[model samples]
Target: MKIIKDDLAGTEIKALLQEHLDDMYATSPPESVHALDVDALRRPEITFWSAWLESDLVGCIALKSLEPGHGEIKSMRTANIARGKGVAKTLLQHLVEQARSSGLHKLSLETGTQAFFAPARNLYLGYGFKECAPFSDYRLDPNSVFMTKCIKE
Candidate 1:
């Protein structure tokens, strides 16, 4: 799979993001859902990427710069058809390498506390992220599970 910086203009990617939004809403309450839609993912603060396998979209992930030396992982999703194929893992490792190259000292993310999010939580933990208090603009919320990892330079 090839992971490249996405320009947010592909019809395939747009459809994939729509599917991602639909799934998030299906699994999360309206008030507790924090997944970003296509428009939100286009923000200048966020650097987005889409994984592709011979023109088919497999997954996507983003890094949102929060402050000097800090970044937040966002919009991570694997295509339903591509699940269990290491797409998320590859995208995550790509983001981690990008963070290191960008001089970031920490990486953080906020995911749901529901069972639907277990795979994601486990994936992050396997990468060395540990549960942490809310950071950036986030506040305590039972629906939210925050995790962070210090980048070992």
Candidate 2:
């Protein structure tokens, strides 16, 4: 799969982001859903990317710069059809490489605590992220679990 920086203007990516948001709201409480929408992913601080197998969209992820040496993972999702493939893994590796290249020393993300999020939690854990306290603008919430990793240079 080819992963490239996306402008977030394609209809396919828009649908994928909507699916991600829909799942976030469906699986977590309204106030606990932290997934960003399409418009939110376009912010200057966030760098978005889309994974594609030829013309079909495989998945997407974004890195949101939080500070001089930190970034928050945002809008990570694999297409329903691409589930079971290594799309998320590839996208994650891509994000980590980009973050490092951008001079970031740490990466963090917030995901739900529900059983529905087990797979996601496992994926992050396998990728070397460890549970941590809320960072950035986040606050402690029972429904949310935060993970962070130090990618020191």
Candidate 3:
């Protein structure tokens, strides 16, 4: 598998993101949804990457620099066909590595508190993320689960 910088214009990637967004909306209440739409994902602060197995897109992840020493994980998704194949893990590892290399002292993410997000929350915990109070522009919300991991410099 190879992870490379995504230009956010690839047709396959665009569709894949749409699917993830739809899935999030399907499983989450409107007020609880924190996943960004395509327009928000294309913002200047976000760096996106797509993981591929030859010609097939397996998954994608993004990193948003929120402030000095801080970064946020955004838009992490594994294609339906690629689930359980380690695609999401690989993409996440890549994002964490990038965050460390970029001098970010901590990486944080906001996910759902519902069962729909258990797998994702577990994955983040496995990678050393710990539950934390909301950061960035986020405020306390029962629907939101915030996590943070300190990246060694």
Model 1, which residues run further than 4 Å from truth? none
Model 3 lDDT, residue 64, Cα: 95
- The lDDT ranking, best first, is 2, 1, 3
* Model 2 Cα lDDT, one tens digit per residue, 1-153: 999999999999999999999898888999999999988888999999999999999999999999899999998899999998999999999999999999999999999999988988999999899999999999999999999999886
RMSD to native, candidate 1: 0.9
Better of 1 and 2 by TM-score: 2
Q: Which ten residues in a row have the lowest lDDT in candidate 1?
A: 27-36
lDDT of each: 0.93, 0.94, 0.92
Clashing pairs in 3: none
Superior by TM-score: candidate 2 or candidate 3:
2
TM-score of each: 0.97, 0.98, 0.96
TM-score of model 2 (CA atoms)? 0.98
